[model samples]
Target: MAPATRYASGVSETAASSPLIRRIAHLDMDAFYASCELLRYPQLKGLPVVIGGGRRKEDDLLGKLQAAYPDGDWTEDSFAEKLDRIPVEFFPRIEGYTGRGVITTATYAARQFGIGSAMGLMKAAKLCPQAILLPVDFERYRHFSRSFKSIITDIAPVMQDRGVDEVYIDFTEVPGGQREGGRVLARLIQKSIFDATGLTCSIGVAPNKLIAKMASEFNKPNGISIVHEADLQSLIWPLACRKINGVGPKADEKLKGFGIYTIGELAAREPHWLVEHFGKSYGAWLHEAAWGRDDRPLETESEPVSMSRETTFDRDLHAVRDRAELGAVFTRLCEQVAADLKRKGYEGRTIGIKIRYDNFQAVTRDQSIDGYTHDAQRIRQVAGQCLKRVDLSRRIRLLGVRVGTLVKAGTAPHADKPYIAAEETPYEQADLFFTDD
Candidate 1:
């Protein structure tokens, strides 16, 4: 929960006039995926809409629109313009959804039904049966992500890209950034994004990233929050320890066990007592976090550690009965991963596969190859070998393939070794049950 408005509205005259006061802003797109979907289907606005499930079939919405309005001048070239005309009744609902897919994001309206990101579709169905279920459209989402981030960089060049829909911007040096403790810059950014994309965002500006992240959530859906170093006690300390960003469920539970629920409680403990209980590094970090102290600067540029792709099936399938289908999907996943790696100019030596059974338990297997290459067939080969180590007798709900231990392509000594497949007998080739693919 957020504290009263005095902290957000008033910055101490002393701190405001200080020679140097760092101001960092965390901007998070509100209901990002769902909002992107709303742009294509404005009729769904203000209605319960959940944006997740599997990938959309090619021109599925176009086909539905054409079928529903045979005489309504719908053409492939004009499909984008006609999206807003789609009838709400034509959308898929969660009422009888049986998939094991989890939501990626949901509209604020649907969230009131307790539907949220990572929640199972079936479970969400029970809460909001009338919620429109749209398959994930990452292509559109990425376009918007790039658009907004580009705008942010144009305004604040020193910005850290956190993910597809969030960023930490250094407002300390930007013009007018210090006015009202960064609220002026935050409001300008919010308006610029909304004007460009018709999307909303919430921003929090604070002395550092730690408190800025928490402040971003204080007022959501196109709201701005400000917190100064002096407001730590009245503003930041009242929030739960879990809101500290790095504190996860396990840490929160352990903190609670020590009678520490709020940041205030954590702050009350002596640094030595916390170090003795939590450990040297984490304990010391906790004490600093509770006091809203973070000296880390924004990381403006970073390389990705790995890349992967995964999908949940419309229904669980047995390994033996679903071998052909599973094999095709398995091969496609490797191809997708390889395509991604090559597109990004990277190669990984480790190949891995993940399996989630009907019971929702997941298992992963991976092996390090002698050389790194972003070759689809080779990835499938090494990944197939890794797959042989997992139990396949049970029904599987989801599958994923990944490559890790990455390096830029051609940077490694054994980067591009030509792959020579061993000629195998039909029995051996078919052994993995993916030969048909």
Candidate 2:
């Protein structure tokens, strides 16, 4: 990798003359899931950490944490004492924990040994034998995620959530667009997140989302990189093809075959030649990506077309014998769906259900409501109706609920209508429903 170039000398001239000096910042949590684990077990700070587990185990751990520390202020020493009290049998064993699952996330320490998200657990163990592995505590992580993003919202109003791990923030309209204001604001946000959650992150300040995303990864854990428009050729052009957001395995392999392995090489290619080799749409996109031209906006609200929750059973249960048991699971799924909508400040007009039989045949059903809603009771009722339409004779391995036709929460709901019912049952709501709670 090439060293990132800086334009510290011509800041004034560039800011005044450049028409495309859009201030964008990309903030990514440093190994988010793994980092959250280490915050509790500080002894695991320098050690390799991995987070993965099934629904039940994760829920149980989250429930204990929520019950013990509702305020999210447990210290490192207190957390260590709590962990020591738990029995080893309750702790997940590498050999016994099995499934067709992949690692949800891993720490920077684990990444050093060539481990990463989506790698198989067995393979990760082989890479780092003594690595400390933990289950993904979705509820706790979601709580912290909301907390940090809310802090960012207070400082920078326009933010686009990439997922639980990262966000793209627009700082052009903020007071800190010129001078070192962007970097200064990024440092403050990073510090605030650390102080609030005891978690650290890497941030990149640049002219657009494309450059900002690339710049963020330039620095490792607990670091920042700022890239101005004038620094593009010296800094962004030398990166490998894989660094570009949309260039995946197939595109990378093809680029390598053509000896177009880096952004610099790709930029050197003729536009006509690229169009002839790749398709018109992709070829044009590749050329522009090389030049670091991205006009993507920073979205504050989440506009999801569909919302869903799914879990794989420890062992496949018979659909007939497990019908009663499945009811609880189905209700939990609906509650989670409703909670997700509430947190994102969204309401869905369409409700759907999905199931995967033991034979791996997937089935789905959907229904549109007369009005949009984020109420748990309404979502559960609609989901229940959809479930009855599906064939339940086959054994089920997984069940899920989905909601679509989403819009901003308050847009459709009248002031008099209560969106989320106060008496709604709390099934998986504890784990799935959290809005800075």
Compare the candidates by TM-score and give the number of the best one.
1
Clashes of each: 0, 0
Highest lDDT model number: 1
Candidate 1, residues 1-437, lDDT tens digits: the string is: 11111111112223335544678899999999999989879999999999788888637767887888899888988876777877788888899999799999999999999888999999999999999999988889999999999999999887888999999998877897889999999999999999999999999999878889999999988899999878989998898999999999999999999889999999999876886798755876787688776645566575454567777787787778888788889888988999999999988877777776665445666666777878777788777876787788888877888777678888876745634444323323534633322
Q: Please report, in order, the local distance difference test score of every candidate based on alpha carbons.
A: 0.80, 0.71
Worst 10 residues of 1 by lDDT: 1-10
lDDT: worst 10-residue window of model 2: 1-10
Runs of candidate 1 with Cα error greater than 4 angstroms are 1-18, 302-437
